[model samples]
Target chain A: MVNNKGLLIVISGPSAVGKGTICKELVKRGIDNLELSVSATTRRPRQGEIDGINYYFKEKEVFEKMIEREDFLEFARVYDNYYGTPKKNVMDKISNGKDVILEIDIQGAKQVKRNYEDGIFIFIMPPSFKELKSRIVKRGTETQKDMDKRMTCAFEEVQQAKYYDYIVVNDDLNSAVEKIYCIIKAEKCRLSRYHIDLSGFKEEL
Target chain B: MVNNKGLLIVISGPSAVGKGTICKELVKRGIDNLELSVSATTRRPRQGEIDGINYYFKEKEVFEKMIEREDFLEFARVYDNYYGTPKKNVMDKISNGKDVILEIDIQGAKQVKRNYEDGIFIFIMPPSFKELKSRIVKRGTETQKDMDKRMTCAFEEVQQAKYYDYIVVNDDLNSAVEKIYCIIKAEKCRLSRYHIDLSGFKEEL
Candidate 1:
């Protein structure tokens, strides 16, 4: 019998690549024995957001203290707000045989990769840069200058996808989810992650 | 657009472990863009066996000459019979983007590993040695001494599974087939095997 450990799947993509949507669909499909890691942030919670559920809302001082204590797996400061992944939450879930998905940006994913080399890194990609631009424009949330900056950032992000373990193109939502589901299942069968206990069989022989 | 190359999947297991059944089920289920590699053997074919379908029946001298020419991806001498995988058949199919599955014994698998390091090696496993013995006994084709020899050989074969890339336990035939299918699909998504042409995207950006 092989009692396999859980997998730490780190997902990264540029803005408007549908990484969040794919993750949501995977959770909605009820992937067996999986959990979404909750991230902590120093930003204010939205009206409908609840503490510990939507995000682990933290004060600036408290977030800085945790950072100093090395309690975060990866952290960053953006526009005076700190966002980080809590190390304990991920470690506890994985140790208890729950596959954990960390949906982060490329920079954060790179930092986590340094600490967890065995983690499966997946980069969600748009079908093309043209489609990516269209999607961003369709969102109607950015100015022309903002969109240009985001497109440049996306170009740089897609370049780093070569370093990731796998890349799923987000042309169709359901199809992308199915591809990711297959990747996770196949990864579980990898011999590097599984160790068969042949003691009982040896005894019979 | 990533026009990925086909995968060379090498499947190996102990005798009577249902590798043939799983491969048949995979084909029956219509695994898209996949084919089973035809093996070359010097042994005499049984009744109903076709020249190029079941096996490529070859004369001993021809097989020997092919071996001298290094025409086999892998080959071995079993008793007085020469069994081998022709390099051309596998290479042709894979080069055309058709995934090829090679079902071979452990010894032949090890030889293939040395040559095709990029190929994915998968080991099929019986649920237990006790169940394995029962299955072999149920087949009703082996004498008592022959059965004992097979059981001993199986023990040694299972031990080599640790070197494989993936392991699928054949507790249920359909489940094993599904696991292998997932492995093939996931391998296609691997960043190393797949290269997305970003030159077009670069022009658009």
Candidate 2:
């Protein structure tokens, strides 16, 4: 029997919905209580990115081997790199009282939720598609062509909002973060987990 | 399709657990947005108790007739008084976006949960059984025997703590109310009802 079951929170959003930034803030506030599940990737590390911290940087051969051995809970290829989550580490952390946060994409989130029915999925969205496009453009990295592609991608992500356990509109940073915090706090108190004994009823009566 | 489904929150505890006072504060805090479910009882009204507001004062035959017609969600006899919840009012309020608050005993809470899977049950416990007993005694309505019976009832209620979606310890009134408030606010953010569309994925790729 499990002494304590940890909750897995899968967070997904479009590229510029500020999921990463808000996650960093969540971590800064006190994520020591939660284990941030880092993904293993075959992509080359960008400048100033640490190997393990940024990702479990792995060779294509090694990444493929894990897939062959069925070591990953879920894996997918995006752009030119293969990304996957290791199952054992996440489960162990959760069983040990650390809630695990998985900042994965929508596809990966759906896959995880299917396999782990208990996991909570949160989908973040911009206030409006126009706002989303503006934020993506403000990043200053995408070319005009690339910007169009990303905005199109964001609209698609917004459509997946209904599947999430909660939808957090990243209209304002503090408000969104506060909403997420409230969700977590409330989930902790869910009645399904409470063990009430009615033996006292018979004795009292 | 349901236009708006209101949430059902069951607040239950032993006598002197401060459930009544806390619920009062919660109502004052705009839970009027949630309709407070007044129970129907066959007991004669005490002075100043309103006919339909405080409770639906009923003749024993009328109460029995309603029970026979399956008009109640749950009902029980306590000290020769018949008490029950009308099934219609709750369903009507929920369909109108008014969350329903049921302040009942633990037994009623458990029964309601069994019938209404969507019902959210919250258990309020005093700091300890000893403290609970003291409070009940200090109320002066109960003799030693009555106090003992109440303590026994409380112990039984506490055992059902695990049955609730949330547990709030009423050590301090303000903080406990705040905690309850947070739980309710956060529950609204649960992902089950909310949806985010990911159709953007198809467009981008």
Candidate 3:
């Protein structure tokens, strides 16, 4: 009855498309028994972000050492900073029957796919490119050039949407979140993901 | 952004595991847009049966001729009666953007899988074999011997669980139906199932 192992869910989307917001919704609701996979980064800690909670902030030299050791499952340089997913923690969580979720950029998402093709990749898309621009503008942190760069990055990022397993359109927040949650719940019922020994069951006879 | 395509879903379960009950719940609730794929059979129509509604009943010779012509996707002979799925009708419905569901037996399910490998296969099971037998007895349509024969058949059917994409435990009717509905919704969001064209979109170059 209780034989499911776990699932590794990778979610990728353009910035300002609410990937973090939806992930926080999932975490807050505690639906489908999922745990967030915190990333390791070489970037300095922000004002309020906890070292372990937001990220395992590492020194540039240490991060470079890990990269040389091939310890990170996926690593990338973003906006002059380094970000990588540590292999050990993610694998450990999944192996222990806890569903692990990685909210990653398109590059890291692609790398994870190359390593673990079995992992579920979900792409979140904005309603339209126009709406996408407005969302970024509303954030009030970026210059016009910064906004342009992000939009450029988004166009290239969405090109990888075809590589994803699921594409959730983030038109409506609640509906989009529900779709992602349902996907997770439904995926848990997959027979291939379970630990059942059907061959040994008396039903075989 | 709007492309209409149909999906074929194959659902199977052991006798008295309440496949019909759960499917009816889904249909009644209009949870997911799905059309039931009624099969064609050569067996004599029992009392209160509606031709074309319950089944597309055909003469034995007609069924045999169709089988000879390879028109049936999968055909089987049981107790001197023939049963099969019409490939043309199912394909037509699917191509028109209708999701078709085939409630089938283990043998038929295997045959459909062999022919239509892209179809979604879902297997329903009771919480335990004890619960299964209890359900059969509660039905009151079978004698003790009949019940044993059905149980034996169920045991044999359970062996095919490994071949299915999903194994849903029918512990609670409402929950099982909800899970099935979620699976359908989630599958529609699959990148492989649907695609969007971004060519017309204005983006920062």
**What DockQ was computed for model 3?**
0.54
By TM-score, rank the candidates, best first.
1, 3, 2
TM-score between candidate 1 and the true structure: 0.96
Better of 1 and 3 by lDDT: 1
Query: Model 1 lDDT vs. the true structure?
Result: 0.90
TM-score for the A chain of candidate 3: 0.89
Q: In candidate 3, which residue pairs get closer than 3 Å at backbone N, Cα or C atoms, i.e. clash? A: none
lDDT at A176, model 2: 76
Q: lDDT by residue for model 3 over A15-134, one digit each (tens)? A: 888898888888888865599999999888989999879999999999999999988889998898899999888888887888888998788888999877779899998888888888
The model with the greatest DockQ is 1
Q: Write the per-residue lDDT of candidate 1 for residues B1-205, one digit (tens) a residue.
A: 7755788999999988989888888878888888888999999999999988889999999999999999999998989999999999898888899999999888889999988999999999999998899989988888989988888899989999899999999999988998999999899889988766788888988
User: Candidate 1: where are CA atoms >4 Å away?
Assistant: B1-3, B44-47, B141-143
For candidate 2, write residues A101-157 as lDDT tens digits.
888877888788777878878888777667777777788877878877777666666
lDDT, candidate 2, residue B39?
93
Task: Assess every candidate by TM-score.
Answer: 0.96, 0.76, 0.88
Per-residue C-alpha lDDT of model 1 across residues A124-202, encoded as one tens digit per residue: 9999889999999888878889988999999999999988999999999988888899999899889887777788888
Off by over 4 Å in 2: A1-3, A42-52, A57-69, A141-163, A191-205, B1-3, B40-53, B56-72, B75-89, B114-116, B125-131, B141-148, B158-179, B191-205
What are the Cα lDDT values of the candidates? Answer: 0.90, 0.77, 0.84
- Over the true interface, candidate 1 deviates by an RMSD, in Å, of 1.0
